[model samples]
Target: MKFENLIMNVGYTDTGYSGIVQVVILRMTHMSMVNYSYLVVDHINNQAVIVDPAWDMRKVEQALENTETVLSGILLTHSHLDHIHLAKPLAEKYRCPIWMSNEEIAYSGYYAPRLEGINITPWSVGQIQIEPLFTPGHTPGSMCYLIGNSLFSGDTLFAEGCGLCFDVQGAYNMFESIEHLKKRITPDTLIFPGHSYGRAPGQKFSQVLKNNIYLQFKNKNDFTAYRLRKGQNKLNFFDFQ
Candidate 1:
């Protein structure tokens, strides 16, 4: 479904033990870059949870109103400025807790105080269970939300590329995280990334493995070398130095 200038990709999954869970992707753009937020709704209970609420609250608010689903909580993959700018307002408005990892809380010095929410570990909203996968790299405490067949891979892993690691250690961590994801997540799982920095906003894990160069590295040292070499040319070169 398309709304305004954003595209809403909808997916339905049956959890075998329970009823169906509906996943909706709300794609929006800010600063000439595309950002995506997700709504995972348990239709049977008329409850929903949001992932990475960015700019443009009206669009998000409209989505909630249209679905007639009460906002249960908000999930943050990481505490980046663009991702969490609207989190405070949304959380206050809905009277819901924002779920973020403790690591993210420590990493984001400025935003931490503003985030009056709950720490993300593993929790459930109705029948839709949320497991926080600690995929740190882009920032400490960076995580991916594992809900059924969907992986909300924040800035850690994009559709075609991965996040920019500012230091060698961060690069290594990012590499390890990707390796961990490969071992655990199914190839058929759908990946909803934080930024639309790829050919498409989201893709299946199988397609991502096939197309992403960073995910192909099996050796940590090799991936680290590659990341450092690549980072030298990017805007964060100063950080690497």
Candidate 2:
């Protein structure tokens, strides 16, 4: 999607200092207009990172300005334009790296000067540390991040839904990814999704498992069937419900 096509701004929220990072939701184009853009900051160091920023560059800058947090870099959950639209410009402006899954790079054909792999030990910007996991679903390069007790789930997971499964293999990987995450992280791990509509922040992961029907599917075939059933139809990114 072209930046000129987007007119909405990113949303912001203060997560307090409970080891949970603050979030900013940047609405994007079409049905994804309700998607969330995230600005996660390290409370102690005031250094921050943005996750799946959509389009509004000014809003991201203002969030960093108001919080006194320096933009460290950008993290991508997938190659979806809505998730990565602002990464290029933001990284260019800050001279920061754009962390992403290499598998997604193949799909996006994204050309950026600072694109870097997100698979490795947890990365740190000041006092905050982020562990990126390869969770392919919704897309071949879908990913998720772990920061302290909070999980910044891009299109992989949501408050009451999981990301759409476009690729069957990728969907299987997503199932495996969430299973691993569930085993490794605590139930209390706060979930900050790529889209939350207008709901409050800090939703728990355990709750999603219980409520997300897509996540409860028995296998990839079942999940695929579900996704096909929920096809976009005539909905634009703005009308996604």
Candidate 3:
């Protein structure tokens, strides 16, 4: 579904799930660097969870009011500034726990009284069952969230591209992480990336595998070279020196 720009700068796209649990996923697009934040709402239970809460709160607030759901938790994909800058404030304002990988807390030292460090185990917020996938590439503690068939990949995996690596190690990790995802992701699984580099937000995983260049690399060395290649450093380059 196309994200229709609403009153605010944010573009909203609502997608519904089926089966024993039914919930709606609202995608907030057009954040800094084309970042996308999401709201997983259980309207029947009046509970909601925010994913990678960043940028302005107006768009997120509007989504809450429209759904009549109260924020129950915040899910972080990683510790990057664009993806996690607002976690503390949003969690405080809504009085909810901020959930992230233990690796992130250790790597970035993200501190908060309400911060909850999670493993690969799956959990639930109301009807929405959240599964954490450890896909560290962009950051040492990078993570991706799996809710039903939707993969909320922060920066690990973009629509047709992947996140830049910090070093040779990060690039290797990203390659392995994506290789793991390929085994789990099915054709129907809708990938909701953290940013839109080239393709749109919600694209089928089948299409992604076919079109994504990063996924084409089976050799870690080649992936690393290309990921850290020249001309991409101005904005995304991370200098280890």
Q: Pick the candidate with the highest TM-score.
A: 1
lDDT of 3 by residue, 1-241 (tens): 3343321211122224343322233444442244678777665588888888777688778878887889999999888787786788888899999999999899998888799999899988876778899999889888888777778898898876888787999999999999889987777777877766555666889999889889899799998999888786565422110
Model 3 clashing residue pairs (backbone): none
lDDT of each residue in 1-241, candidate 1, tens digit only: 2223333443435355456666667776675545778888777789899989888888788888777788888888888776787788887888887878878777785353335434556678887788888888889789898888889998898886788787888998998899889987988788888765435554789999998899888788898888778425554311210
For all predicted structures, in order, the TM-scores are 0.86, 0.80, 0.85
What is the per-residue lDDT of model 2 for residues 1-241, given as tens digits with 9 covering 90 to 100?
A: 2212222222222223345455544444443365567777665677788888876777788788877988888888888777888888898888999988777888778778999865646767765667777777778777788866767788777776667665667667767776777777677777877776434446677777787776677666776666656546544334443
Off by over 4 Å in 1: 1-15, 110-121, 230-241
Where does candidate 1 clash, by residue pair? none
TM-score of 2: 0.80
Residue pair clashes in candidate 2:
11-25, 24-37, 25-37, 26-37, 30-237, 30-238, 31-236, 31-237, 31-238, 32-237
Give the per-residue Cα lDDT of candidate 3 at 57: 80
Task: Return the lDDT, model 1, position 150.
Answer: 84
Off by more than 4 A, model 2: 1-32, 197-199, 230-241
